[model samples]
Target: MKPLTVIGFLGSTLDASKFGPSRWSKWRPSVALTMHEDLRVDRFVMLHGTPHARLAEYIAEDIASISPETTVDRRVLDLVDPWDFEEVYGKLLDFARAYPFDPDAEDYLIHITTGTHVAQICLFLLTEAHYLPGRLLQTQPAKRGEDGGAPGRWTSIDLDLSRYDSIATRFAAASAESTSFLKSGIDTKNAPFNRLIDEIEQVAVRSRAPVLLIGPTGAGKSQLARRIYELKKLKHQVQGPFVEVNCATLKGDGAMSALFGHKKGAFTGAAADRPGLLRTADTGMLFLDEIGELGLDEQAMILRAIEDKRFLPVGADKEVSSDFQLIAGTNRDLGRAVAEGRFRDDLYARLNLWTFALPGLAERREDIEPNLDYELDRFAEREGTRVTFNKEARERYLAFATSLDAIWAGNFRDLAASVTRMATFSPKGRIDSDCVASEIARLTRLWASDTKGDDDGLDPLLGDVALAALDPFDRVQLAHVVATCRRSRSLSEAGRALFAASRARRTSSNDADRLRKYLTRFGLEWGQVSG
Candidate 1:
């Protein structure tokens, strides 16, 4: 076994005594610590200031006399004010850094019974941080009934709490709770989405930097942003109010006035001095939804505000400061926008530091079931009427919703609306098969109408005669394929998106060739469909 080493401060009052055997009658922590038969410390590192040098030497000699085999190493730690936390911690930290610690050969113990409270705390922190690689040794004086002169009891506390199952379990539970809170307690099951949320939870709690959420509309970007703010508030990271703004609604001069605040007489509508959304969110959070919709000028201003925390209002020479954490949400591709000269590259770079892309409902089909139940619970709370689907109806709705044919154009919004409609039209409180069937048909019609709006491109590509001969299923499928092709950069990308689920099962697959053959069957080519 490795030799035991004890490192502690010299207790000026507790360890002081005249040069005689009578000193043994009085219990000195340092002297009694060496007398313990079980704890055979091979080395005792005694620390003290310049004023306590003589006392440190006297205690070292006494400890040596008691246990001649033990080596007592005296260290001088000069401190101006022992009560000052910063000074004490800094001095100890420096000492710990300079000390040679050999954990492999020596079992180290930090004695906490011989220092100021500040020094004890600093020692605990250093040990916890592993600067002092050892366990804490807390010594208590003997009880009143016990022998007052005898060496007191000592307990060793390991800083690595994972060794203790109860402590480890509690920490894990707390972490899971934090992640669940960030997800708004939805219990999402999608593996990628769950991992993303876990990473987001860590970043949200630790960072005040700008975060950019990228996803399609109704993918819950705004809701997620609000949840992040709420989580931060729960952690006491922010004290100000959560200020949310939809940049899509702001236009030209109004956008500037609303965001950066305008001085009196700045514009025709600006009659009074207005503190903008940024100022209102001071020392808090600012969520800018549909951020990509903002104009180039506004984007530049926002970048300045984020970086410098100060910006000038309209018609004002002076600058106003607002230190707010920014959370930007956008469906549009800012990188593409930057390439097209629409968005400022600098602003995009700034916001892209901590960017997270949320998957749409279609991508996370497994999560839809939980979110469905959540939506129903929300409806019950809002309407003060509980509603549920029968077994068959619930299974039928889930089957259709999870199927590839169901196009969730509005993502979660569409799911919520469908649940609301079915709940409202259900006979009594329970949704029967008839209600679910009618809701499904209604959703199909709505999705079909949306597809038809984009079907104009189909007529021109397929021509009148070819389109007239095709069946309704063929027409709809071909129209969707052609539309996807037009939107994608290449045939391969379109095929990958079109066959995302099936492609995973194939060991050796050529999506481009498969797409080429499918297009050939319909007398269409990549150039014609993509063009």
Candidate 2:
């Protein structure tokens, strides 16, 4: 079995012991820890200040005398003042970065018992942060009541918080709060989508690997990527600005020069040395939106850049390096693009490591109401105007927005535009039935124009065969009937809407009976039409 390596500060005062048969005078915590039979120490890395260098040597000699088989490596880490946490932590962190760690060859432990309080804290931080891939070992003086008392005891503690219920609960709650913050406080109803966001929130804070967002346009891929960057920045996980590029807008050599820069006089437009978006994203995040639109040559270069962190700029002789986290957003099916020889299959495989799919607004209609409020809030902040829908108007608009008629082809973007139009047109800070009606009409016209084939809306209700059998005049009339029936809650409501002019002419109104009879002519009932 591979032996365990122990690392810590040399306890100058406590480690220099007087020779004695009594355990209290003879045993030092660091020496006792090394002497533990089952907990074998193969390598000991002792950190010491200049003042304690001689004492550290004495401690090392004693440790060797007690545990003859272990190898000792001492490091001189001079802190101006060991009590100053900032200075102490910085020096220890630097040492940890420089130290060679081989986790596969040996298990490791941070010996926290021998250091000053500040040094102990710094060591714990390095270990917990994964700069030191090791558990912690603290040695304690032996129990005094035992006959002639024995040597000190050693204990190993793990930093995995899941092993402790109370800590795990706290961490889980904090993680949930962070996830909600990343989502802009919007509570999504779709369980899978919510879970996906939660996972993404964790990954954004924990890992710096490339993330690929796959979804249709306006599905919030770009927004989520920016949010991830913001979250990482908020946590101090990244120190640079978020740089975004839409690959779809980039074309040819201009795209290359824009992303990777060029040497002075390298091209006609290159008047001076230019640093590009990749370098701008150093120590931060790079969001490549519509990444599938990138040409094959750029894809190959990007693959090299992501894998090697080094790439030669356009017409540049030497390669520049930028260590940036990548977040790629795409509406296209890259797998299909790969099969068709459009995208590089190798690059696709690399970016596919961490992939997420964002659902479009049409798929999460239940979230529309909350997102409506969110968009209105954004508009108010941006335009310096506040607009709200009346209770009835809000209900009406939400019903229509959630309906099948509202195709929402542009997803969140479409919803945001709809809200913007209504909010802009609303007078006196309130949107009523009139405003809702106008916006609905405008949206309907927009959606209608965007759609292809039949403008005859009866195809959904009556199907093709039934519609073909009907006269052109009858088809038009039936479309109106079906639409009215859909909007009404009952037969009488449909009758009132469809026969408003005729009902006014009648002395005695049997509107419900008339509507029922009319619907029977088409072999349709209230349930069939309304549902």
Candidate 3:
């Protein structure tokens, strides 16, 4: 048996207040502590107030999601109550007795960092008793003054020299690589909606609750919902097709029957048995749009469906079962409605599991140019137009986009309409500020005429400039340009970086396709950008 590595987690009233759950954004304090596979490890966490056993399961789930390859025995040990050190000693005795360490396996890497007083005492006990095979402290606040002033200085301490160093180094490298990989992926896509994507992920993973995405019409609420569904699917947390219903259009008896299904002859109008939206959405996501408009009675029925995971079909004698994750979207403030007795509080409570407030187009001023540019590309591709942005026009578009205040209050629909107008009115295949600004004025009039309000429109477009140095790909592509112009390495030097390493001996046409993809990411093309 290898040394039974014991990891100590701090679970105390004080520590609980400082870390865990709410500190979700904090990158793990010491990736160094958790990185090695060579050492056998176990984890113990302490929490103040909350049930430790219950919290342990949440932590275990999170850790498994993030690092699927690792295995560890996890527990929450409480010893701070009654202010007795013996409570701490008693718990450790049981743990140490069960899985005695075997140093021969190069085993027993104890990594514990939790927020609890009992955990701290346990750390001290293991060190004093010489039973701590390996240990890791996840976080340490700077020592504060008597009056809570600065304790001063930051430091790192490690034990177990070679073993600890080896483990930490390997872990750091892998962590850095993963960080770099995600960064590269995000950068490559220029994902302007990254914030929305991130919010959905955190909300889904952290809480087993319904997420209500509220935004103005055409603000891409449905699109965002589908994107979230896809991401959840990728994570294997969701398996059912995304079932969507626009509640504003669902009317009277039809709405109930559509959502709850009906048995033949149960209702006067019913001719045959029908399965409702509730069942159709079994084991998947049910996206309800315009939920604020659902009638009071229908709201009660839907609420029951969500809370009980079962619902009665229209005209059906018995209830049917279906499990579905609910994601509701609305433009109205349901909270205010609840207070005014306009919305059902009971149903609201169930849907309030998690709520995400989406920023309107006007609020996300920074996103205007990118979204426009993306739309422009889509239009250009659809038209098969050889469109490249001109400097003055692009800059002017960007300026207008960033300058808007109440951008139509219509959200994404307004933006799409603006894009269509700009594309339709462009004189030169490329668009300029005139295109963006003119549409804004036009949209202002159209929206204002419709609502008697000067609701706003999209900002100007941002122009793209070819890098003076060309991208890495371009530089390499025109290597001959480099060879002839810069008088640098000949075609040979360029070929090596541009070619596959496997074909060191044969250079011509060697893995050029693979090289181009990597080069494109570098922002380079053959002769134009390079040399």
Best candidate, lDDT: 1
Model 1 residue runs over 4 Å out of place are 1-179, 455-477, 482-516, 519-531
The best-first sequence of candidates by TM-score reads 1, 2, 3
Evaluated against the true structure, the overall lDDT of model 2 is: 0.79
Clashing pairs in 2: none
List per-prediction Cα lDDT, in the order shown: 0.84, 0.79, 0.56
Give the alpha carbon lDDT tens digit for every residue of 40-134 in model 1.
98999999999999898888888888899789999999999999887887788778757888665678999999988888887876675455778
Per-candidate TM-score against the hidden true structure: 0.57, 0.54, 0.47
By lDDT, the candidates rank as 1, 2, 3
RMSD values, in order shown: 17.2, 21.0, 25.6
Off by over 4 Å in 3: 1-197, 380-388, 425-429, 432-434, 451-531
> Of the candidates shown, which would achieve the greatest TM-score relative to the real structure?
1
Per-residue lDDT of model 3, residues 295-387, tens digit only: 888899898888788888877678999888888999899999999988999988888767776666655566666566556545543543323
